[model samples]
Target: MSKAFTKEEDGTEKIRLDDLPQSTHPNLVTPSGLADLKARLAAARLELENLRARPEEIDSTMAIAVAERDIRFLESRISKAILIDPKDHSSGVVEFGATIDVVNEEDEQLTFRIVGEDEANPAQGLIAPYSPLGVALLGGETGGTVEWQKPSGVVELEIIAIRFE
Candidate 1:
């Protein structure tokens, strides 16, 4: 019989999965952000252990690949986290971990909390410190005006208040 007709051994082929890329920017994180990263890393490690212990319960190769990738990514992120306590920063200036209240030219009030990239959720008002609005707001004091260059156009935001958590 031709070799093609024979059953191949289980370990005959190997599958390689590439690691997730790490961000080039500094891993600036709030105290909560660092805690969240650590928690996620712990969860990933638990999941990896579970996957390895029960390889016979599922598609072991693909499942193991995903779990391992998550572990590596979370571990790297946790390792790179630089925790910055909001209370330790300047009280009056808009800096990282500062909660800011601003008003646009249209008189619409908005609030944003500057946080780490990993903890940024724009819809919920959490913004990355390097984001356009965050950059414009940083270093600003109460009653200051900043022009944010958005893709639509430049929008001016007036600083109403700034507080640290």
Candidate 2:
């Protein structure tokens, strides 16, 4: 998975399944995935060929593709990047794997499914506990609000409740 994510502000609808504790996936390569990655590597190599032929004409698109390929290469090293144990419980206090219900500044209710960096999905409302908003909520008790700095200005969030899935 890619570390970069496009977060949507006006999005809604979420369900927190369970908190994953540890990763128990086998540390081995998937033969099919390896084969597919090899093909992509070959295709990228071909693109590089065309790029090399016109060194002065290569643009940012090709450059970005190369960079993305590099990232995928490194990511392929791990068999299971994000593993949810499906049994992690933070014991009431908001921890790394806790699911929280937050009300935004507009008084609209929202829920964010917090996960690890590998499993962070903004669309699914899964945020990394280490992120800015996540940091503010860590170790916080219910009924209190989490304050943080946003691009527009300072923002405050109230933790209505926490649901453990």
Using lDDT as the measure, which candidate wins? 1
Compared with the true structure, model 2 gives a TM-score of 0.50
lDDT of each: 0.84, 0.59
Candidate 1: lDDT of 97? 95
How high is the lDDT of residue 130 in model 1? Answer: 88
lDDT of 1 by residue, 1-165 (tens): 111222237543323467777888888999999888888888888887887788576476566667777788878888888888999876678999999999999999999999999999999999998899889999999999999989999999999999887
Q: Which residue runs of candidate 2 sit more than 4 Å off their true CA positions?
A: 1-86
Per-residue CA lDDT of model 2 for 7-104, tens digit only, reads: 33645222222222433433222233344445656676666566556645536444544544554553453335334432355466776566788887
Clashing pairs in 2: none
Which one is best on TM-score? 1
State residue 118's C-alpha deviation in candidate 1, in Å. Answer: 0.6
Cα-based TM-score, every candidate: 0.88, 0.50
